[model samples]
Target: MSELKEQLKSQIIEQLNLEDLTPADIKNDSPLFGDEGLGLDSIDALEFIVLLDSFYGIKIEDPAAAREIFHSVDSMADFIESKK
Candidate 1:
């Protein structure tokens, strides 16, 4: 699970082109949206959907579900593992 979390962090930075942030800079439980954590916006959310599909082959069918699933790296990793 930890390994998956690390992979998620890397994926996030890579897929989102977050060149300013390193994998270690992002907390596993940190919010991925808003000004609270990564300061990500809705555009990043759309990219996240692409990231899920491209990397894990997991397509998020419902846009609403992305709000909860992409809330944090931990949650995203859990979602990926469950889909597997």
Candidate 2:
């Protein structure tokens, strides 16, 4: 789980073109998309859906659930483990 979370941080940085941030810069418990967090918007949410499918081989059919699953790095990792 820890390794997956670390890899996810890297993926997020690369996928989102967040060149300025290192994996260490993103906290696992931090909100992923909001003004107080990474400040990602709706388009970034779409990117996250792609990220999950491409990297985890998991398809998210529910948009509302995606909101909860993608809420934070910790949540994403937990979701992946649950699916597995």
Candidate 3:
């Protein structure tokens, strides 16, 4: 699971062109969006959907649930595991 989270962090940074951040800079439970976290906006959320589909072969069928699933690396990892 830790490995998955690390991969997620890397993929997210790359997908979003977040050149300023490192995987180490993002905590497993840290929020991935909003001013309280990485300050990511709606566009980043769409990239996340793409990332999941491209890397994990997982599709987010519900846009509404994305807020909960993409909330953090931990949540994303859990969601990936669940889909598997």
Number of the top candidate by lDDT?
2
Pitting candidate 1 against candidate 3, the one with the higher TM-score is: 1
Q: What is the C-alpha lDDT profile of model 1 across 1-84, one tens digit per residue?
A: 999999989999999998888899999998989999999888899999999999999888777668999999999988998988
- Please provide, for model 2 over 10-75, each residue's C-alpha lDDT reduced to its tens digit, 9 standing for 90 to 100: 999999999999999999999998896899887898889999999989997876568988899999
RMSD from true fold, candidate 3:
1.0
**Candidates in descending lDDT order:** 2, 1, 3
Deviating ranges (above 4 Å) for candidate 3 = none
RMSD of each: 0.9, 0.9, 1.0
Give the alpha-carbon lDDT of every model. Answer: 0.91, 0.92, 0.88
lDDT of 2 at 18: 98
TM of each candidate vs. truth: 0.94, 0.94, 0.93
Clashing pairs in 3: none
Off by over 4 Å in 2: none
